[model samples]
Target: MTGELREAAEPTRSEGATYYGRPVIKEPVWKVPDVPAYLYLGGMAGAAALMAAGAGLTGRPGLARAGRVSSGIGATASVAFLVHDLGRPLRFLNMLRVFKPTSPLSVGSWVLAPFSALAGAGAVSAATGLLPRLGWLSSSAAAVLAPAMTTYTAVLLADTAVPAWHEPYRELPFVFAGSAVASAAGLGVVAAPAAQAGPARRMAVAGSALEVAATRRMQRRAGMVGEVFGQGRAGRLLRTAEALVVAGSVTALLARRSRIAAVASGLCLTGAGLATRFGIFEAGHASARDPRYTVEPQRLRSR
Candidate 1:
């Protein structure tokens, strides 16, 4: 009984409250989860802007009108979701008070403000039929902002302390861009007639190609935290994503003439995009829950 009491008196590794002797390695943090919602909406807006540019260039006024309307709606909706998630909507004005290149949220906010304005203008012009005169200007602006909108979400997420998200920074932007393009293409197919949806199909092909490449690189390059991509729920979702995207790409390319094939590919692309987004969210949360991801990397970097 005395020997057992001595063993119990010794401190085990678990006796320390926090990792490494620090009382508080990190404070209790709560970030707004709706940021991703804004990201998804912003991606849609970017794609819509690109579609508007293409439709205007192709001389399809009706398609252009649709694209403008879609872009405007997407941008407005993103802002609404962002504010709704902010906990205090009035504080949103502070986001516009300064320009901070180092701050992704600030930069994205400013970028979205103007992009939304331009998109709104394009939509109104299309509705009022004034875009014929200002087509070049609006199209030029939208084209420039389209890629940024498709990609900035990567920076936005990486700015957070989430291990899975931060470690895979190199590939996330491409993955997001690819997914955005695919989603945009899918939206195009749904909104426009088969003939006008040609560009959307092309976008899907390009986007899927990029997404596959980026996702593969992420799995290969991220060492440990990226391992989540191949484990548990994340692994299942990513595998399903790859299969669907590949099948959809093949179907779209080989079955171009078949409406059924086009529809199938579009649906697959949409599903893949959704899966990737949700999978990423889940993976980040998983990484955050484990202390190793947060501490080990920082220790190595400091050393």
Candidate 2:
């Protein structure tokens, strides 16, 4: 352990002690709003693309159209946020030069580029009523790529040195997948007609359940690093997300029968997704900013 935090940590080493009023590690340089927004939109768009593809193949044209449009917009916006974080569009393109399966950043860039193009093209064709076969094919391809898009962010975060993020790698992917599904479903419920929204409402309920379960399990398994999730700003946002999930899940059950219910459920689930992304981001930062979380977890693992 570093000298500055050694004394502070000694008194309560089991609990990771404290920061001793000084940061023990170099904080992440990722920007606010940009990174968090990218995370949120990437998940939403990925799941939306998957749902859209399924709808298209299953004869649910309205739902498919809505999903394609939402995915296209969300994916395009997600790329913008990611590019903004990189500080240059060319920097993002540079990452595409090598297909490094082991590098999350490189892999993510590759997955993102084609997924965005196909999803966007699918949306365009759906909207203009041109090339229906090609649009369906494009959406199907995007769907194949969507699972990676939704869960890859979790993998990316887990690869980081952040205590909270890296320690909970196994659970994070599940949480991300569920959140993505819920967000995509929320969009469908909001945009699709009631007759065409049945699948969406069901998806929302299922996804919300998975997200809530995986998140709770992750917290319990996170050990002391998990404490950050329930403290300060992170706590508030996560609690709010949980509340919203519960409310939204219940509301979704009533959605197919009532437009008002559908709208409310959609907003709540989407809002929960946004809040979860920000909250998880904050928790990772908090864990890194305080050295105890990092040092202690490593200490225990080394033993």
Candidate 3:
């Protein structure tokens, strides 16, 4: 028998089928249904935190109260969806039992613990109409948690076996972090006037800079794995995000010319942030679809 035939005898593809290259061995553990729901809810929580902070800064007690309430509701809903997706809700508690720096889930659980606490405090402060009296302390706490809560999902996904996610680890966190900042800025613009939104605009600009830099780095660092960012659905979403972020930054910087332009900039930045999350999720799925992602990485490690 030929060497090809011998290799074919133990085919990589499913039984009774013959293909030259390896077929998919492991499929994506990250379900499609889980991705968007998680991303949206997390962003919502982050946005609420930003809004609450901006309200506190601008002396808008009512907006601060509303922002806190919204944050709590978002966090609660996010937890519900996460548990439902896991199928065995009890496993979530076990996630908190230990700390492993190498395990994204463990780290994320820790991040969530404080995030949830801050959200609850914000909710209580708002519900009791006490945020004004508590001063910047409550808002400051929320601000600190906002970025972590918003960005850690990227790490959670990256720590997994998925090739696209794992390979892009360095840039993924920054991508999510940038999105969080931009999303927060968008919320600030909607909740506060120009006086307070100035800081938000600056935040958005910083985020855009980070996002662009991280994306370039991802393209350079990821060899064949990075192909997803330049092709298919993932490519399109990324392209759109790039355009939106750049345009938004320019408008924000030049918004002194027009208020309508400033609003448009905020809208674009918000849209870009959403697109980045969706793009990353889609790229992970694409990477999982091919067996190369699974077998190659393992084989490399073994060697």
Question: What are the models' TM-scores?
Answer: 0.83, 0.93, 0.78
Candidate 3 local lDDT, 94-174, one digit each (tens): 798899998778887777766666776767767776754563465568667787787788878777777778887888888
Question: What is candidate 1's TM-score against the reference?
Answer: 0.83
Among all windows of 10 consecutive residues in model 2, the one with the lowest summed lDDT is 12-21
Q: Better model by lDDT, 1 or 3?
A: 1
> Which ranking of candidates, highest TM-score first?
2, 1, 3
Model 2 stretches astray by more than 4 angstroms:
1-21
Clashes of each: 0, 0, 0
Q: Please give, for residues 1-303, the per-residue lDDT of candidate 1 as tens digits.
A: 698897777655654322643422242243434665677778878887898788878976655666777787778787787788777867777899999998988888787878877777776776777755674476558667888877887888877888888888988998888887777676666566666767777777888899999999987777767778888887888888888877777666644467777778868877887778767776777677666667667766798
Q: Global lDDT of each model?
A: 0.75, 0.89, 0.72
lDDT of 2 by residue, 1-303 (tens): 888788765765444445454667777799989998999998999999988978877888899999999888888999999999989999998998899888998898899999999989988988899998998888889999999999999999999888889988999999999999998999899899888888888889899999999999999999989999899899899999988978888998898898899999999999999999999999999898888887778778889
lDDT of 3 at 250: 78
Cα error of candidate 2 at position 301, Å: 0.8
lDDT of 2 at 197: 82
On lDDT, the leading prediction is 2
RMSD of 1: 3.7
**Among these predicted structures, which one has the highest TM-score?**
2
